[model samples]
Target: MGRGWRGAAARRTCNPRGPCCRVAGDARRPSRPRLSRSLSRRLTVPETLPSVPWRGPRHGRRVGTDPRRGPQRRRFVTLAALLALTVSALSASAPFDLASSGSDVAVEVPDPAPVATPEPEPEVEAPLVVPAATPVRVLIPAIGVDAPIEVYTDAMVAAADGWIDPTTHDVVSWWQGGGTPSSDPDNTVYLYGHVSRLEAVFNYLHSVVPGTEVTVVTEAGEIVYVVQEVLEPVGKEALPDDPRINAQVPGRLVLIGCYREPDQGRRRTTHNIVVIAHQVDSAK
Candidate 1:
């Protein structure tokens, strides 16, 4: 065999898939040999190579990695290990909150959902009316005048045809359109009587002095009122317009009665008296 063939055959026996080998100068001294510099450069081989444990073709279950793929496998394993360590640290630690100061890393956090607002309630206003109790009788003790209360419609109290004699002789007429004594305080209790020649009803109305107590018996209860003022010499048409009578509607009692003899010529009542009173005690 040729000398080069003998050396190449020996190298194949030693390393089947590894590196190239050099021929020793002497066979007796077993000196360390190296790959040729030109061959190593041409093959792009590393300076140091791992030793192969076996001398034959690898059949089953290779002990180590392939030399060609070793560097890539090692790099992949290292990267995987670093990734595992970073994931473990992130999961085990608390949440990350960035500072106002500048940073290279950015963490995304979603905003919370918006809260719903409730609308305000509307304001309610109080009504100006209340349940009313119809008055049935009125008694003025100072004048010894105890009379039945008569509710009159607007047209009746107006007496366009003139005040009826029998209707006003011994009875008191209540203007139903006005206030009820026991109801809303703002309503004015208007009661009036005609002057009778028998001196029965309002014939003595002029004698009813101030501070006199008047009692009103209603279907609801008894309401007591004290005389606050008396307006005399009032005309029948302007009697209701008096400031004292108009001002006291709430819990007030107003009494109207014709004064002096009727004018036979004019066929009309000449003078009238008006009494204004306020509630002193509430009915039980």
Candidate 2:
């Protein structure tokens, strides 16, 4: 038995074509691990990973948040303010019309009332009457004689010296002697003064000529006279008595003075120069 067992064992140990040999060959075969291609591709890790900052927010994280939107909002606000100010200025300066025909009426201006004036009073007049009698003042411009007329009297003739008769001073010679009428209606008013004496008041009377002016100022009015004639008699026979020298003639004056001789104090008795003048008008 032993021998037969020994032979079987040897056969088992050295067999190339038996079931035991096949089992040994299976044990020496390479094991093929299950290769999972899908899982290996899914789990792969990159050699260089992209770097990212690990901080608060990512660069492109929020939706619709552009950086330029704030300045654009400020610009839109400024434009709106400018437009509002322009509209306010235009509304404040609007024009207006002031005509009366429209619903907007104008104020009325009334006409001024007429003014009244007062009347003036009338003037009164004085009554007509003769003024008081005042002595006539005679002015003989040629002889430089300006003296008051004096009535014929002894005292007045004494005052005039022997050139005139003391009692018959200022009286014409024709009026002195009673032969001539005392006063005639149509004759000249004669006045007489001595001219022959050296100091006679009428010393220059002979120089008076026609057309010489004489002024007679009296209380009533002034009378202007113009010389019309100058008379000088030749001799005592020519000294005829006449009432015409004593008359109250209108508009006439007669002046008489004695003629002088060559010898002193020897007067020509009859010859005289007479100045005749006419009255013109009243004084101013």
Top TM-score prediction, candidate number: 1
For each candidate, what TM-score against the reference? 0.48, 0.40
RMSD, candidate 2, Å: 26.8
Cα lDDT of model 1 overall?
0.73
Off by over 4 Å in 1: 1-131, 158-166, 261-268
lDDT of 1 by residue, 35-103 (tens): 898987888957799987888786755646457567888899999999988767655563543234244
* Candidate 2 lDDT over residue span 63-96, tens digit each: 4487776788889999999998875665555343
TM-score (C-alpha) between model 1 and the true structure: 0.48
lDDT of each structure?
0.73, 0.56
